[model samples]
Target: MGRNTRKRRTPLATKIVAGAAALAVGGGGLVWANFYASAHEDHGGHNRTRSAGAQVATIDCPDVGQKIRDVPDRARGEVDGELASMDSQITDAYQRLATTRRAQAGDARFVENSILGPLKERRKALIDRIQLEINRAGGKADDNLDELAGCQGRPADQQQDGDGQDGGGGQDDGQNGGGQDDGQNGDGQNQDDNGNGVAGPVADDFIDINDVQPNSRNSRNGLAADGDGGSTGTFSTDCGVNENNLFNSDNLIAAPGVDNGAHHTHDYVGNQDNDAFSSDEDLANADTSCQNQGDKSTYYWPVLRLQDGTQEFDANDQGGGAEGNIGKILKPAQAELKFVGSQQGDVVAMPKFLRIITGDAKSFTNGDANANTSWSCSGFEDRQVTDKYPLCPEGSQVLRTTNFQSCWDGQNIDSANHRDHMAFVQEDGSCPEGFQAVPQLQVRLAYDIPTPTVENGQVRNPYAVDSFPEQLHKPITDHNDFINVMDENLMNEVVDCINRGEDCQ
Candidate 1:
């Protein structure tokens, strides 16, 4: 891989100082904070502040999807379209902020007055349209949405996800470790390899694996307790590591029919016809990348890129460099997709087209309440770090592990926020009430990337996961998307293998 040769922009003013803030832990043990102010929120006027001698890092907007509990079936299409438009507005505003660093340094309120102000107005208009769509379909519009239209400017190096402590057990029994690297020099202004000065993946976002304490989860290994009927079998599916180079920025589940909805490219495997405009019938008939033709399920996640200067095919595209995600995309050395049974009881077959999204793509601004990223090194799999990218030693491959939700609500194939239909297993390895255990899909991707360097607070040739422009390419924002399209017989076979304590491929 070529070394990152892009000219890094140095902030003209004093470097940003870290901010002292607290995160409010939300559901699923995730952490969050109210970044928007209340008054004039209806008109998109929220309190935005920059710390003394600090720079505005990225835009922080309320997640409109999370706030909208329900959209009538007839209004779903229009509501989704408006949400996609809101994302585009944020991307446009961020692009302007990134390209106007010099102007921002010259004017104290340039970011607020020029970029954020107009961005909020646009968001408010879109949000109003969303309200109208829901009400027109005879569905109740959320009252809190008026306050969600406004976004604020967050200072650089503000802590969002991990606690200040160095090492600790994770929030679940499955994985007992999650923490972000807390190393910030705060000495120099630096731009990522993409040349986006304010958007991040700064030097502090990486940590050496040797520095992390061992915090792996205590797995039940699909074993059942006395009298407990647990499914103990395993099934493995062989899907190529996106060798076909299936790449796109569309999020079919979140913003269907909207091009470039993701604002970042994804590496796809499994179903061949997965994209923004793909319908259920299209996916069912699509060619399969999996070794088993019956397993046409679609699996995808954000592509990991080496910050080297080499421009890939999407270098000039909207979801690529144009949105601040630029680099040479790296193909995973190994992509392992496995299905394991529940520890508490037998697992049922996943409904076809059941969509599940793990982790929060906007964790940098929304906090880590829903963040489930587990990054480690090959030899250091037991030491997983959620918020920080690991600097694996020579000969050790970098690893990204994703453990999907194993419990399903059994009714709907999808939910409004794309999350209410599924739930993670409880600490005791049991499913929640009204949820049944399903074969949990675990994805592990290994990459052979050279360790990046942090010199005088400037990161050189770092490897970062693709992210939304305003998310700053934070590792905590890493996420995965899945659509179960397995044929009925194959899914039943998977359930049978798990329930019968047998291993099958």
Candidate 2:
């Protein structure tokens, strides 16, 4: 292979998600176990190197769970314990994969065959045993092992069936696990007097199209919101599935906690398994609790919390926080969601199976100087705002604005960089020459953290995202993803709302 030859992960290890229904634990939370890749490198099979910004291909695992229902009663514990073990082994193997990839001479096939393949077998065996327990428990072992097996190590491209569409099979267990799976039980179990629980929502559940938050707040600095001023058409919707405890095993890139893939968890809304490895077909069929029923779009990010000391709201809530790693999840004391158009032309319905990412994931280091970020206090954008994460005052909330480009090049649904196919809205909020203007999605996340405490004569940093021991955590590290599943009627309604300048629920 040439020096620029990016190692393509041939179908070897498929993704196996412990779907929300079957993997849901006692407390109502859900989890899954898998080790797979998410996306591909933009470069032609090249060794990923930062010197030239080479993107390396990775092992994108399939999201599995719906096939196997969780065994009922205490027997569930046995399967869960085994699942936990599989998660650990997978995480360890992938951590090694990540480490080896960093070396110039890293061999992708060797990593898959030697490091990851063995773990896969171990995991399969454990899952087989879990299935037996489910059958013995009278829960009906209706899981499709064939389907689950098919998910292992398949490419995103081949995910489609012969019909050339995303082939989503199996059933949506319908047992919503967002509230229960994140190490807590019941709705509002983690919420306190301040309202920071997994299912607790704040502010207006629906945003008025005419009343949008200021896209740009930085004055002294020339920084603009990622998609600010570029909005030609705009509408708002509620951020879906705001639960924090899902152990979604379909992470494309193996971050710090890749071994127990889902342990280093996130707060998910919208389509439940919105992790890196999810596809359009999977998202489309996902049972969501968001408004506009058929809209199956998925959106997710790291959960933010107060690191000081609350049993459930402790430091472990952030990314890699479970591993005693360096990063912490920063919450926006407040959040907002909106859609903008990237062109002067009428906003059109986003095609099905569209994939897009906001912010940048590669840059989320532990706690380094992060550039290309926008932060502000809920009410005081003038003073409490800066590129640095501003700690919220008592009763005040912090806000981070992430705007994704909406113009599609009309060719590829996704790119190696998770960006290439999509272009940002122009300063005039219009799409460029060959691009079509779609609704640019905006996610405004809020956090609840007080001023950094002065400990040992120094102020500590509070607002941050997940980071690993090796990966330097940076602010630009905060990133999110989206796959539109809005039903045609709902999407058209949004398009009409933007075109007619009418406010809506």
Return the top candidate by lDDT. Answer: 1
Backbone clash numbers for all candidates listed: 4, 52
Query: 359, model 2: CA deviation in Å?
Result: 1.5
Over 130-161, each residue of candidate 2 has an lDDT whose tens digit, in order, gives: 77877787766646653342112222112223
Candidate 1: segments with Cα more than 4 A from true spot: 1-54, 161-198, 216-228
Cα lDDT of model 1 by residue, 148-209, tens digit:
88887765534444533123211111110111111122222233322322244666677899
Poorest 10 consecutive residues of model 1 by lDDT? 23-32
Error of 2 at 417 (Å): 2.5
- Whole-model alpha-carbon lDDT for candidate 1: 0.72
Per-residue lDDT for 164 in model 2? Answer: 18
